[model samples]
Target: MVILGLGSNLGNRAIHLKRAISRLSRGSGAVLHAVRLSRIYGSPALTPTGAPAAWDLPYLNCALLGETTLEPGALLRHVQEIESSLGRQDHRRWAPRVIDIDILWWDGCEIKSDDLTIPHPEILKRPFVLEPLRDLIPDTILDSETVEAHASRAGARASVGEIAHSPDADIDVSYPTLMGILNITPNSFSDGGRFLEPETALMHARRLVEEGAGIIDVGAESTRPDGATIDPATEWARVEPVLHGLRALQGEVRSLGRRDPFQISIDSRNPSTIRSALDIGVDILNDVTGFTQPEMLEIAESTDVPLVFMHSLSIPVVKGESIPPDRDSVEFLISWAEERLAEFDRRGIKRHRLVFDPGIGFGKTAHQSWHLLEHVERFHDLEIPLLVGHSRKSFLRTVTEKPSAGRDVETLTVSRGLVEKGVEILRVHDVEGHATLVSRHHSDRLSQLDAGAAVKP
Candidate 1:
């Protein structure tokens, strides 16, 4: 029997442990079967005097007892790969991490190598590891004492408790959420002039919510390359009626017993339009222009709502003179986004409430847009949830010989890739397709969790 201790002290601790367990169950050189697992425990930080401040966070630790055909050294390599895949980084000892996996014991076999040591040197002395290991393997003997005895002896020194992962605990990152597009403008490239009327727009918004859209992005003006921009007053007039209707819909959904109401986002760059939408209580502001205006920053400072700053070299809806010379699209995007984010920091906007969109088709050439999508994971360094609006953009049109409406398949294809790369919010035109895809993905994870939870002592 192989036993591994898993722990995480940063960023959704429970999800990290569960994710590691799930990955380990899959093949890693040799097939590994999860024989039994222990309940997740929240433990106090193991901070010595010389530990860094990052070790201040508490850790969620658990133990997994499994059967594997691979030898100890090979298994150690596999576990290290899994840790790095789940966002663990090389940092100082006792530093907080996204996930940490240690080979507590391997088949009662003792092995020593430069890279790893069997029966972890201090495993018996640590209550966090011993407690969970004892639960899975009740009679497990470590060093000269039984697992239970070691845990009992050190239990008084450690603060630990059983905890389960919430259904929505990993909602922000584990699963890709669909943000349905609700363009209320008459000049938008897709769905423009379709739902300009208040009732029609409201009906479509309701349909989006019913179809499993976590967010409904109601854009007043078109941000297409060849679209025209209206003044703030004209823009607000277009979206005002629809906003009022959706505000009422929010109450209706809540009265009908929905716990977390669907979020509504205003997709515009004008300060006046943002102010009007905020006055009517919009949940998020998605500025395609990166929120560069002084008044826009002022509004962000005064409001506590989440804001999305899309990366674009020029203002939306207006065609740029020419595409920039070929270069590393990921580097360019990161640099541009970082500079914009620094401005937000100076404006006193909270980083926790900030979301970054890569601006798929805002101003880039067809090649540039595809390059950005291909390497979307590069933006995870921003350390926040990413919003990808790849719903029927010009990039798809260039790849496939299809019109705007016919590119839903391409959009779905890209959406699946983004979902796999940990893209959180996907703004799409086809809510049902994206929602169904994400729903099934989340369900598979849930099933794995259910199966793991069933593993007891």
Candidate 2:
């Protein structure tokens, strides 16, 4: 395990840092696969006592935890080459540069050499380093104190520098993709009986697309614990008309000169319903059962659409059930996802088309669900896109005490956190609210980046 500290203060700092990360991940002959990335921290640049005022520009800093096959010396040389490629020049000490990558820690080894140092000598004194390091490993013991403890102490010092922007303030970053929910069932949890009619569902689908949904995940069966269990025929009956209506709507949009409009996804576990939806034309398949059944796998093998394999212990999700207490939630989830990926690979399904969902509120206690949200970054190690559907679920009620309809505020709040943690897609009910949240966040990030770029050295 190695932790590398990255920072930049000149010429679009976010871009520099991102480019450096990309280069580092592809080290020549020595693979450096980043497993976890800390939240990007913006701090005032550190300069020498007699340095020019122009050198004190604010910098975007972050730490990356990764695994590598190279030794300390080779790794240092590799990063130095990456730095040179990214336009890093070492003309003077503490000088502003396009990129800076330092090996912070390397497999708990303590080494002192003329070229490199393990456990960076100034790691404890620099709050910018500690702040992001704490995000990756809060409880790591350093200098006989936890990283979190050191961060707190360094943070209290007035000279440590103020945080200027949130982690998502990057001009080149991809914002969270929105998956709009269209429930055709009359007993769905959040909007049950609201859009049961085909016309109403079609209108709502159009509204969702207008509000910024890249995909509309249409479901005809309610998967809630106490919800009714319908047969494949009943499910298809509810779903068929909506699919046709959506296709017609797509045609209408294209006729009006709209090209490559929103995608359509079927959110059902029933094999019959899945086949019918795919027969008509659905861009994605969202299996709440995680494709455990042979028929579901057969359908997956037949189609090339992206598959959302959500983790659930049961279909309806028995109430009061949760992952075993002895097992770690994040580890369990990653393991389950890995197994699914392996299964898909053995069956000749392209692994790249798979997306994993933690299945929040399904067979999980409120606390367990919240814990998964807090440590959501761990799932990124799977190297697959993630989709989270925490929209107005029972978990939010644990804190907001609001019913399904009233949890939009809480839903938006949690969605923001999830976006910050770098989740790829968000399956949401309130498309407008999530859309507004995403738009505002992107606008703020652009403003910050613009301000940073305007700074003259």
Regions of model 2 farther than 4 Å from truth: 1-173, 256-258, 453-457
**Which stretch of 10 consecutive residues in model 2 shows the poorest summed lDDT?**
448-457
For candidate 2, write residues 305-423 as lDDT tens digits. 88999999887778877899788888888898889988998998865467789999998888889999998867766756678999999988778867888998999889989877767
Prediction RMSDs, each to the true structure: 9.5, 13.2
Candidate 1 — which pairs collide? none
The residue-by-residue lDDT of candidate 1 on 1-457, one tens digit each, is 7888888887546546655655665322323574565656666777889777767887777777778888887888888887775668765677788888889887659878787888788886777787677666656677677877787777766543523333443443346667989998887787789998889999999999998887899988877876676888888888899999999998999898654578889998998888988999999999887888888888899998889999776665456532465668778888888898899878877665678998887777778888888888778666555799988887787779887877899898888888766676889999998877866766765465455443421
Error of 1 at 72 (Å): 24
